[model samples]
Target: MQAKEELQTHARSSPAVFGYPRGRDRRGLRFVISVSLQLDSQGCLRRLQSTGHAVGPQGGNTVCAAATALMRSASRALADHSSIVISGHAPREGVLEIEVLQCGAEYHAYLRGVTDVLLRGLKDLALDEPSEVTIRQS
Candidate 1:
């Protein structure tokens, strides 16, 4: 119960999906530090999203669905060699303002899994498209 509450707290306090707030600047540099891994877990990750103030009832559910989709896609592409599990807090202005962490022992496998999906994701993104994906806006 305590863990569940903490999860809810984090979700509630997290920034919106990816939209420029009224007072915040959109063109800002983000802080991120990443390390290479050889035995990482396989999975896809998404930033915690925020739009208005509340994360809403489906916030967690939506994130879970996205994670599952990414993992399934990546896993199928790579067979059973590796898998990915991603988690992060969405930013207020940028698409995803956070350092990506690759968890698990098969770090290398995880890295490849993430990379495979990332390349595909980048291809799917367009420069003109806004990063914001909020409940209200969606």
Candidate 2:
């Protein structure tokens, strides 16, 4: 009887066990990745930013990985292009920002192609994981 009482007391004091209300625990929360795009007047992508983490299992998160890969690939491609002047950085974990400083008119078509592919990949990922990813454009 005393052991049973002690067990009940322990459970009451332990948040991991019984203290959190149903559906209100931290484990029940969903982490969302937010991707933002800034477009120039000509409808060209001028900037991109991504923040947040899509929490998943112990090994890795497929949604977050896919989003990060797409953004990084786009940034690298733009930076490597001779006609595009770009700056990019990962300010912190799970955050990335890239801005286009200048671009030669001759290479605008190449920029458009890269931007289109990045945007398409991100949109597809968002569609597949509606609860884990979000996209905003400005």
The TM-scores, one per candidate, come to 0.26, 0.75
Give one digit per residue, the lDDT tens place, for model 1 in 5-51: 97767554423433434423244422111112122133333222222
Distance (Å) between predicted and true CA of 86, model 1? 6.8
User: Which is the leading candidate under TM-score?
Assistant: 2
Task: Tell me how candidate 2 scores on lDDT.
Answer: 0.77
Candidate 2: stretches off by over 4 Å: 1-30
Assess candidate 1 and give its lDDT. 0.36
Using alpha carbons, what is the TM-score of model 2? Answer: 0.75
lDDT value, residue 76 of candidate 1:
43
User: What tens digits encode model 2's per-residue C-alpha lDDT throughout 1-138?
Assistant: 999787546533323353344322354432567899998876678999887766543225677788988998898988897889998889667678899999999989888889889989999999998777899988
Query: Which residue runs does candidate 1 get wrong by more than 4 Å?
Result: 1-87, 93-95, 127-138
In model 1, the worst 10-residue window by lDDT is: 31-40
